[model samples]
Target: MPLNIDFQQIFLHLFNFIILALGLYLLLYRPVVAFMDKRQAHYEELDRQAAEKDAAAQQKLDAYDARLKAADEEIQRRNADANRQLEAKRQERLQRAQEQADKLVEEARKAAERERAAMLEGAKKDIAEMVVSAAGKLADKEIDPAADRALYDRFLEEAQAAQEDRP
Candidate 1:
């Protein structure tokens, strides 16, 4: 409105503002942007490393799990084998014990039978001798050992009758 209010001063102020803007862009803005870009790149690299570490850890864990599973299976197999062996041993022991018991029982039975047969044979011989002595006493004479054996057989009938009368 004043026409002479100093146009040169206005132009100089605009030039100074443009120069200030250029200086700020070159010195502060670009450096700040570059520093921010570098920081972002560093963070990206760290993130990638972290991802790689996580993947490696996961792989190790998987391997450990596989090994544990295999160990468990092996242990189970060994236990089963041991159990089978124990059962077999138990059965074998039982069989041996049974065989020994059977053998002992058979031997005892045979010994008892032999003892019974011997007792019966001795009793028969004693009866025969008693019959001969009794017949000799009844006849009031000494008997010839070999000649009266047939006559002594008659006493066996009387002995059997006496046994039948006993309760």
Candidate 2:
């Protein structure tokens, strides 16, 4: 049982461990960890900006859709009003044309009635004059002019009485 240990060997082993740790931190571990942290922070900032931009674009699209819908409704209302006004004007023109046609027909009927009455009156006057002239010719020799005139007047009176008695 000898308690004999090497101090030089122990000191050399401790120095080697410290040198190995420093090399690992400087060449491999610290650089990789720092690069990973920087990449994570960049990706997070990009994701946040993308989300904000998407929300803004969505709001703009919704406002545009609402404006288009309002414009379409306004056009529909204008078309309906125009159709109603056109129909009203058409009806008014048709009614005016019908009224004018009715008036023209009425005027024609009145003209025909007036012409028929005039013809009837003229025919009656011609018949009366012919009867008086024939009676004067028949009594030319047997009666004076004044007496023949009186006789023709009496004949005309009797003729009117006979016509009245007939059915």
Worst 10 residues of 2 by lDDT: 158-167
lDDT of predicted model 2: 0.83
lDDT of 1 by residue, 41-69 (tens): 99999999999999999999999999999
TM per model? 0.73, 0.61
Candidate 1 yields a Cα-based lDDT of 0.86
Q: How many clashing residue pairs are found in candidate 1? A: 0
lDDT of 2 at 163: 50
RMSD of 1: 7.3
Stretches > 4 Å off in candidate 2: 1-15, 126-167
